[model samples]
Target: MSEGTEPSSSSLALLHHHHHHPQQQQTPPPPPPPPPSTASPSVAGAIVRGYRKGNWTLHETLILITAKRLDDERRAGGSSSSAHCSPSASTPAAAVPRSAEQRWKWVENYCWRNGCLRSQNQCNDKWDNLLRDYKKVRGYEARVAAAHAGELPSYWAMERHERKERNLPTNLAAEVFEALTDVLGRRAARRANAAATPVSTLPPAPIPLSPPRFPQPPVIPTAPPPLPEPAAAAAPPTLPPGHPSASGTLCSPIDITRIHLEMSSDSSESENDDGAGTAEPEAKRQRLGSSVVRSATVLARTLLACEEKREQRHRELVELEERRLRLEEERTEMRRQGFAGLISAVNSLSGAIHALVADYRNGNHR
Candidate 1:
């Protein structure tokens, strides 16, 4: 063969290796899971003579749960896609059905269509058991979170109080409730959020430090002008002493002093009226000032109370932060100690191996 026809060293090496070792066989994949059982309950069935009988498969349980959730959404008049019920992104339904039997029937129909083929009674019983287990798991999870937050003592006390109120603790293992909480946890979360309200979220009462603005009172006159008096009739021109002035009258003399006294009485009565009018307005202004002062005092008290509550909450927050920092420091110290012990252990193990090797070498020499 010519130089150009010669095989490369790398290709020749691969050929030789392949020739020395036969091709390895590929491995087969694992077998598929068994299909769902279609057998009905019988005397010899594992149901133990009770309708609860056979254990529900994971597939069947999921179908029942999904169907019930869909029915709930339907009742709520909400539009939700089937993908929402998938394990990766399961969401809470909008609402639960008010009619139990109707909800169960719908669940049964859905399960049947999806190849689960379970009776309404079976669906109802299984769901109830699942829900009860879900609650137990959730309660246990709450205790774990509380423990991590250093609140286990308070959490345990609360549980004891609940027991005294006739609420019993669950005995079932939390493992049995796995996969359940992942799907139903959102519903419980929604309910809790809806019920909970913090004091801080409340709107504060508006305080008006300054008194409310009132329309200014009109300026009142201290004294009113005197009332007009009737004018005295001019005495008949002194006609000849007794001439014709007494022609048809008995000549009665005009009393000038009586007229002056009557005019004086009218003027004094008008002055009294002006004085009463002035006093009335002054009394009204005094009443308005008193009421304004009372309102301002009440507002000041309310503002003080709000300030006290804010201070208390701030102090509590600071204390909590101190506790968290202390816990973090303790954890760091523990980690450092653990690492030191690990290093010491490795050194001791290396020394022991060296000692064993030395002993073996000495034995061979002997």
Candidate 2:
């Protein structure tokens, strides 16, 4: 019985020794390292390639593998057509309908997850185009603010600013009134001056003509007492059969009167001719003066018209400048208000995110 008990004890000890060995206690190899997780970099490349081909989604692993194989093709190159490419296609189709804020968040996550080292400017340019579409759904001012914040594209910002300037209200009536006032005042002043000026209708003075002067000869007066005998009495001499001399020359009173009358007629005719010749030059000078006055009047009228036009243009420019300044002020005020709203919204969003993170951490801890 002792011998049988000894053998039983020895067998039990051997079993115990084997169970205590380090090799037997070792853990099985960790389930073969989880089969390397079939999802790979090729999957991401495939998704990008699908986007290039206008495919909204990629379901097959083969497509993903092909995308990985042709990774260089995804980059914009000479052969690639921008017309066929959709920038948003590079993102997951499921995320397309997300809000601008959500899209931005996803982009940030994507960069981080993929270990992309793109610059901030590159990120801004991408978001800018995305925000332009959001602007159509949102209002103009909201879109403008998003663009200014780098959430929208730079081109959209410029276009929106231009539109705002074009649509701004103009004060045309004020300009018109100012122009009218300046024109009417100048016209009224000119008319008043014209009315106050005296008009002269009297003929211009004739140029003075020097009178003809005759030299007076010295006068010698001789008083003769003897009376001359009649020539017919002294010459009554011969002529035997004809006594023509005796009838002597007795002057005819009618003949002398007729000769005097002829002389007076000649004098009257000469005086009339001289008067007509002297008046011609005076009439010509008067007409020339009238022409000069008329020319001056026409020139003054033309100058006044030109001045009035210039005054009107100046008034318009002034009004335009004022309107532009007012618009600038209004735009500045609007920008200030929008910035305030943006700041408030950003603060609220940040607080919400922080709260969400805190909740997640607490839940995890629990």
Candidate 3:
């Protein structure tokens, strides 16, 4: 009985060893420890879980997720969804992700890029209509983004069909049309106002009339009148003997005859002396002729000197006039150049002002 029991125990041990070894081989190494829990329940995880559990609405979920993603992307220096999702891409419009934060960012960027802040009611009509449609279709967030970007389908039959399917309101559509009409009216009014405005242009200055200067008549020197010829010197007269004639009686002819002979001799001597005096006057007349010639020569020299002085004065006046004309021409040229420069400056200033006004309106003043 002891020997039989020992054999049975060995068989049992063998059975146990075979069973354990096969089981160990078939167990598959306990499935490699379940890969560790990498996903932790942080704020983002809680939000995502809440969305999946229907604790948050679709729009709210989208908003929260978009905000989280954007923040992460920004930190990582990657593109934001709002910037990457453009309508020009081939991606279906509905396929684009829905997020309130992304929509808001898209709208803000669109308005800035297209200068919609200053846009008139008519300019904003399409966006308004799109918003209305989006609200009806539960796509308000998307509408907001598209409207902000100032992008809408063109006015056409296709757009109309799409709008109808989206259940857009007729009243809202009418408002958009009305806004366009208002814009047209305002533009027309502005054009009319511009036409009515008067432009001021200064009249050309009157041309001055200068008085003409006439040349004076030439002056001629007048000659002095010639003197009349002097009369010949009068002959000397003889006197009677006053003492003999005191008794009032003349001497006898015979007695006088003897005295007459002596008187005749005396008369001859006197006549010779008179002839010599007459010859001296002829010499004096010749000397007077030479003095008159000298005076005439001096008068001619004075007239020539006066004529030369007048000619010199006239030449100086002509030179001065020419110089004045040249100076005036130079001044006119300088004024023309200055006027051109002024016009260029005014144009540049106008352009700068326009750019500045545009930047301010777009909220880009900085």
Candidate 4:
């Protein structure tokens, strides 16, 4: 057993079988590796992976978003010579207390302040996941909105809990939605909807041209009973001045009928006066309603006219700019032609001078 040479195959086989028995499989696995050095981000990342590898908690996510916003502000206002650059804007720098490793380590420290306990790598990973999920929710919302005729509902219009059977249409959680909204601002669709709300183009409801007619009282179809002869119904038989009827002490049939007819006419006239009184307020109300409608119409027309003028002004400016550019190009071409003509004239004069010099030389030689 203690020999230097390797053990025979049969002995090796027996040892392997003895150690790998099914009963031994129930034993616990080995302990995880010791935490790594923090000397480098690479090693630090490994330690984070080993320490706490799980889904981010909601409070931790909120902290991350808040910290990111603060970091951006601080970086944006930071001195160009010493500050780590904000994401898109930056200037030259030599060094600072710590490196801007992916511009995230400081944010990680911020999360740590809230007892988040996540490394920069974890923070980065979680942030990317949150964005990815947020985008997916946005896309789903867009698709849902497309089915309707008009603009989509705003993100903040509905509460987070109501977005599902409860929420508007997105199932994303309240914390995540709010965090993403704060970090990213409103989505494009939401912004567009908000922008379009003020420019309604449909004409205001048409105003009726004339005041409505008042309802006429129904006419009575049956004619009054034939009046008694004037002698009977018109005047109580000219009773003697001291007669009982004249003194109002008693009435004959003729006098009674005359009183009845006279009383009826008086009651009818009083009813007409009461009807006029009741009709006055109703007419005033109708006039008031019409005046309001007319004022609204005038306002709407004014707004439309202003909009048209703005569009017309824009068109004129665009046309003027085009004309200016065209004239500039033409002016450039004319200058180019003028320079060419000057060069051609100079060459022609030089040729004539050469011919003249030749003629003079010939005559002198002769």
Candidate 5:
């Protein structure tokens, strides 16, 4: 073919390469960047309904209130969550049944938004269970006392004392009154009307009988007995005012029964005093035990959360390490392929140049 008609060797070589490789079609665009992992608002809203959220029992509710009160105490002491706080990005629920933690949170929110409550006792759930728990504790205390005394402690008196000290009757009365007020509005009026009603329908009392007069012989008044002769005065031995023998003190009392009764009464008073004295200590011990239990619970939860966080971080680190090693291997493979392609292209160009030179040399010789 003529030089003008045929394409140049270099150009033909480039055309051959393009025809074989064709530039690498553009790479799919990279998967669209993975959809966000969060749930849609509409779906979340549908899941949070009546039965979905757990129920709040009476005791649980009471505990929630106590927890709320504690939170208030903490907040009022100037601790705040503001530094790390951020508005939640998640969609709001229409209504969610609360877990224990959520219930406490709700209680805190309510307490903070509304002013102080009138009374904790306003929760008039029958405290029979609470009373039973209290009694159980008392029994445990009695057993402890018995163990300490090396004999069974008489719990009857202690129980009576506990009843009054705990004001169980007062609590019951208050609960009953509150219930009545709720069921019967204007209980006072009913009570007053009942009091005003007459008792005239009852049977009358019996009449008293008059004593019969008895006849007795009249006797003349006798003269008083002559006074006994005065004995010689003897000086009493001097003794201290509090001395056992002071002021003619006798060794034995004339009335043993009276003395015994007085002694018993004194002993009873001492026992009462001892009971009262020990009560405050027992209360302090119980409070300390409760605080310890709460602290242990909080610590356990904190430790568990920390452990979960650590494991998550570890998993992320492992993933990152895996990704890095994979990328390193891919980069090394890409370099190897690029180097191989460069060498192949150079070799093709050299061959094309050599052929053109050989063809020129042959044409000149001819």
Candidate 6:
């Protein structure tokens, strides 16, 4: 087909098909649906329990979820913020769909790694209901704590006081006169009694006209008495019989051995004393430890008692509120029934009066 002839429509179609058809290869089938997500049920359950127990906050859960999602995205070779030049070019990861249950799973895994939770089970609906009730209890506790903290005054007491003040009629004249008499009488009596009291006849104390004299001390200290000189050693006694020189010296050697033995006994006794001293301290420490344990146990029991009482009081309050509501409902129903009966009675009375009037007009009383 020459440019001048302008190719026919069928010829153009054939050329177009030839150019594009060969470039297209058979499309491969999509990889089998990703093997069911490998999420651990244990991790999910732990997250749920921890949240319900108030051990983990919602903020922390959100952080863990975000980190897990980002990690997952990275592993899947998804684009990150750095992959783009402009900040706006990358979509925020938070924009992705995130649910509470999904976040809980991430938190559970995080807690597991941190050793925050011990058990690994699926967080079931049971725990969810408990957590809801627990939140309500916590809210009531917070309100109580706030009231005790004096963030808001107790309105009930204030209202009671106001009512009392309003009911009591004031008498200004009587109050003022009584107040003046009570104050002035005591003051006048005090002044009169002071004036009537006798004065002491004792003379005034005398003052010295000259400077005080202090005791004087000698300039030099006396020398201490000299120590007495030690006595000279006595010569060894002469051998009595001279049967053998060694025998006489034998007694001397025996004396030296005795002295040595005495020194050794003293040392052993000192060691025994030292051991006894050390044992005393150890015994004292044991006693102190026992005392501390006793005190701690007492404190624990006191706190436990306080907590139990507080819980009991809250239960009573809830019961009272339910009872009040029930009573109000009953009262409302009774009032409604009373009104209906009252209207029926009025209608019946009117009918009887009308019948009596008709008989009177027709002389039926005859």
Cα RMSD of all models vs. native, in order, equals 37.5, 48.9, 57.7, 31.9, 40.2, 34.8
Question: In model 2, how large is the Cα lDDT of residue 152?
Answer: 49
Per-residue CA lDDT of model 4 for 181-299, tens digit only, reads 77665333333332332222111111132122222343233333333344223332222323332223212334433333333333233234443334433443344335434444555
> Worst ten-residue run, lDDT, model 4?
198-207
> What tens digits encode model 6's per-residue C-alpha lDDT throughout 1-366?
476456676688877886787554223323343332345555555356553344434443333334444444443333323333355644464356556666555645665665444222332332333333343334444565667576543223345454245321122123332333344345444433332221110111111311222322221233323222221112122222222321212123233233233322232222334333333333433443354344445545665476567756766786699899999999999999999999999999999999999989889656
The true-versus-predicted C-alpha distance at residue 133 of model 6, in Å, is 8.9
lDDT of 2 by residue, 1-366 (tens): 999999999999988987888575455555555554456544664455322222112122122222222332332221234323465753454344335444343443344344443323344453332223232223444555666575544333355455446442222123332333444455455443342222121121111221222221222132222222442233222223222311222133332222223222222222334333333333434543454355446656776687657655755776799899999999999999999999999999999999999999999999
CA shift of 348, model 3, Å: 3.2
User: What TM-score does prediction 5 earn?
Assistant: 0.25
- Sorted by lDDT, highest first, which candidate order results? 4, 1, 6, 2, 3, 5
| Candidate that scores best on lDDT | 4
Off by over 4 Å in 6: 1-276, 357-366
Which stretch of 10 consecutive residues in model 6 shows the poorest summed lDDT?
Answer: 198-207
- lDDT by residue (tens digit), candidate 3, 259-341: 23323322322233433333333333343334334434454455547645754565467569978999999999999999999
Best by TM-score: 4
Name model 2 segments beyond 4 Å from true: 1-273
lDDT of 1 by residue, 167-187 (tens): 324333334455555545545
Query: C-alpha displacement of 350 in model 3, angstroms?
Result: 3.0
The parts of candidate 5 lying over 4 Å away from their true place are: 1-273
Model 3: colliding residue pairs:
110-149
lDDT, candidate 2, at 126: 37
Candidate lDDT scores, in order, read 0.51, 0.42, 0.41, 0.54, 0.41, 0.42
User: RMSD (Cα, Å) of candidate 1?
Assistant: 37.5
Measured with C-alpha atoms, the lDDT of residue 76 in candidate 5 is: 29
